[model samples]
Target: MASNKFKIILWSVGILMLIFLGFFLYQLTQSESVNSIMILLMLLLGLILGGVIAFLASKKLVSEPAVITESSHTIAESMRKVFKVVSAEGHFNEIYNYEETTKLFNFIPSKKKALVIVQAKVLVGYDFEKFKWEVDEQNRKVKLLNFPAPEILSTETDYKYYNIEEQFFNLFSKDDLAKVQQNGKQQVIEAAKKSHLPEVAAEQMRTLLTELLAGKNFLLENPAKISETKNLIDYRNMNNSR
Candidate 1:
């Protein structure tokens, strides 16, 4: 909007300058004693004023500040409407080696081994149901008393069997294949976790909340650790102390 307004101002200024130049030419024709220096000076003044207007037009419209009049509950409710916020996507190529252990006194190695190449897409996101927060208009902040940790929201996996060596005595069964599939999925999840997917997702969420509260000029703060098992401690007293 601001850019469009500035563009309009620039075109208007250009047209006005052209008109002024045409008028100066007409004055040149009308009077031989007309001071060309004075006319140029006047045009310079007009250009300066036009530049000022253009600069003002390019500025942000501060008349309507983002003042969040809605209650914290309302904001939270609106956020819930967003449901599962998938912030990052990770494509993983993992090799999961699945083997059945020869459990002879728990000291035997599995002679049967199958190399499973797993290609998976992992979605990293937040569960808003676990989101705990409070909007403190006092501090101009939406304090995430309990910011939900990024988790593997979903994992889609495709497995390709590479080297399948099964002993005649301990052959692969349905249960073994199931274990392989599960392990392959787990490998993809682990790979996603080990990558920067969670960090990227967290940064994205922070950016999102920051923009959402930009109108209010509010900060997004996560004081409590989402990895902790305990509930977010009542932070009102803490904030009060601060």
Candidate 2:
């Protein structure tokens, strides 16, 4: 907006200068006694005034003051630290079982069965290490420009195998236990994601930024250009689907 206003002023001044020049030229042609030196002096005055206007416009709208730049850098540096903005804990329990049997040439078959009880706890939140932002010095506002989507930060699983009912036929292998634990962790993560953890984390971050900037005499712009976590989640899902 500031730039647009500056452009308008620049064009208006240019057009006014052209009109003044044209009038001066016409007057010089019509009056033989019109002093050439006076006309040059008037044009120089107009040029100097126009230059001043241009300089003021550029200074006010095009360039950021050093103090503003310093403030922005200070905020950026402070935000570089990792923030565990919000966390959601999820508990998941799943049953893992498989059966196998061997068949002989004609008839008799032996079967095996194995089962495991798997449980896990998952933690999900935003790591502010990837958070991004910009300072709108012209507007005296701090803007959250971009940030990483919420994700499952960590998963811890505890699982145990049930005693085999038929040891000869169904036995749990090391790979089977590993797969069960992994599946439990994945389920917990998915459950946590479905909750409102991301939105909570975003709101926490917004509050933190507001407080931080307030101390520096800067105001945080609400409904930041692209910082809302709800929108971010939708965007991330859309991108992943693609």
Candidate 3:
């Protein structure tokens, strides 16, 4: 939509310039005294040339920053995938894959390149609470400060707690864990230990473990599912307390 509007504005400006040029040409032809009219025509031609040069220069100036911004975004996204691999658990390594693509535009005659970046994220595991926590924390901090929040240790800890409790009450399900028995118990233990969950949040996960072991199913199935549940519980509790 914005691109369409910009195109319309550009076309309108060009049309107005052409109309002005036509009027100047008509005035030059109709005048009986050719000297003043010739001079006026030369001035009008200079103005048109000046306007075109200014338009091209402005387009180059505007396009450079947008190209740089898109390049930076692409680089940042690449860094994220590289870091995720370096830090991810074996469970994640086994389950998922990452890919990215960029759309390039050459808006001008120069070798200047503008990009539109798109990242594709696919999750294969049933347990995506950890990923959700990281995303939510980033979003929350960004919202609070109106800036990209740095992933410092303290902020990461907070996110871990939030996501773990969030996942425990939400994503763990009997069917999901049915295949993860004593054979895979070691893997599960290692994953839980290496996870970024806080102590309190880890303790809460014990109840989920118990339910899974006993072959009971939770009504909720994901972090988003748990968040909805939390909202409903909060609403009901608030009403009841009153």
On lDDT, the leading prediction is 1
Residue 113 lDDT (model 2): 60
Question: CA lDDT of each candidate?
Answer: 0.70, 0.63, 0.34
| Reference-based TM-score, model 3 | 0.25
lDDT of 3 by residue, 85-189 (tens): 111122221211112223334342222111211121111111222323222332232111111111111111000111111122234345433322221333333
What digit string (tens of lDDT, one per residue) describes model 1 on residues 155-174?
77788999999766678989
Report the Cα lDDT for residue 20, model 3: 79
- Predicted model with the maximum TM-score: 1
The regions of model 3 sitting more than 4 angstroms off are 1-3, 54-155, 158-242
Q: What lDDT score is found at residue 235 in candidate 3? A: 15
Ranking by TM-score: 1, 2, 3
In the range 56-131, model 2's lDDT, one tens digit per residue, is 8777787565653333333433434355544444566767665657665546676666576767665555666676
Alpha carbon lDDT at 21, candidate 1 = 80
User: Against the true structure, what is every candidate's RMSD?
Assistant: 26.4, 31.3, 23.8
